[model samples]
Target: MENLHNDIYPAIDPSVTKSLHQPGKVVLITGAGRGLGRSIAEQYAYACVASIIICARTSTELDEVEASINKINSAVKVTKFQLDVTSETAVKQCFEAVKEKEGRLDVLVNNAGASLEWVSIDESEPGKWWNVMEVNLKGPYLLLQAFLPLLVETARSNNTVVDVVNISSIAALLTFPQSSAYQLSKAALLRLTEFVDVEYKDKGVNAVGLHPGGVVTKLSENNDAIRPYLIDTPALCGGFTVWLTKGARTWLGGRYAAVTWNVDKLLSMEEEIVKGDKLKVKLVV
Candidate 1:
């Protein structure tokens, strides 16, 4: 066994700040209009990513996020697309545009999701419950299906690693009354991450599921029933995502991680975690 204390729990160094720089990379982020998605885009901009394509259902929100990113780094090529992730045709068009304009995509962030009514299973409206699934699980499925070929192609041609970062939630692991629909959707999303990684790992494409923590965003504000639990900042997930994409982090591929985990500590435990195949969804025998 590894000495976790000496190896993993080192003191934080206040003087060191981590940043990722991918000057020619192109990233596409769904739900990039606000909150966690917006923060993630901003971090990528700061990292000097060459091109960023942001898509969401609202044009106004997308425009605002684009402007914010440009202000951080005017050199970054920012493209805004108003998209409905639930619509396969719309997702296809978005990726087509990315391929036409950018030629290749380095990262795809499936951040768009919905958590409609927070009622118990029995009380939940059938249409609303299913809508959550449509956005949370089905949307990513559509995007991943549409984008995998392009990601794999880019990786093979350039000999570089590509990524799919699914913004999952801790709700996937924990159960709470009145939120079964959201919980089930996220749990399925985590499984999707594993499935994609397993299928595409050999092709230089990596997929990861991440719990963005309890960022107080419009998604949570709209659901006053769960506002008290929202405590983390969007920047936490945003910065962590840039870190995840900086290197292949092959050891962490197909796994689910929490933004609350310290990056340095997690890196320290990489060997042990990978050896044991930890931090992934498992059947509790």
Candidate 2:
């Protein structure tokens, strides 16, 4: 709840902006080519992350991210890996490359996602659902399978913890009658994160699911249902991401961190606000 316009979204020259100054910690982000992915990469780079692996199907997009990150922090390492998460071989190779280059990974952000025209269960093509599942669910599954060893390796080497943040959606927690495939795919991912969290806590890898709310991105351009509520920005999402990483064990982990007010209220343990109870709140950046 920080001052959005002042502390968080103050206008500044991109040229003068610098990295976050967090050297020696590596972070791997999927779909780092555009939208939220690109923003998250920039934010992390600004934070001075030791190394950032920008993974995507487009070498050009990855290259753009790398250039942007390096421009902000030349000392930060930025590596690009072309990958199609739907392909198992590609996923394996990407992680192997990370291991070879970074030696250790401190964070993994599963932000790659896919969408299609709205379709109901009765009329939706099986292929459409399969495609959604493959990219949204199976992609993360493949990534976790391939890169989990490296996460563990990092933790064992540092004798600390690492994080895996799954980019889920409000649709995943709600009933989307039109886009059933997208909803189901994200819902499955939520369950997947839970499973990983429980299964790997002792291994030192913590996993959590997040919903960035409606944002003005390609994913929302054509989806009218979700477009209007899309008031959040990529930078805001990026900020929340870093915050979550810092407070993973205390404020997050094994829980859904959503931008939706209703979701937050529903999940809150505080008593319901009854007709203007003068609620106290804190500003967040």
Best by TM-score: 1
- Tell how far residue 197 is off in model 1, in angstroms: 0.7
Indicate the TM-score of model 2: 0.84
TM-score, candidate 1, is 0.92
What RMSD value applies to candidate 2?
A: 6.6
Deviation (Å) of 202 in candidate 1: 0.4
Q: Model 1 misses residue 222 by how many Å?
A: 4.2
lDDT of 1 by residue, 1-285 (tens): 231221112122111333367778999999999999998898888778899999899999999998998898899999999899999999989889888998899999999989876787788899989999999999999999999999999999999899999999989998888889899999999999999999999999989999997877878888876678687778777777887888788888999988778777789899999999998889878
Regions of model 1 farther than 4 Å from truth: 1-19, 222-225
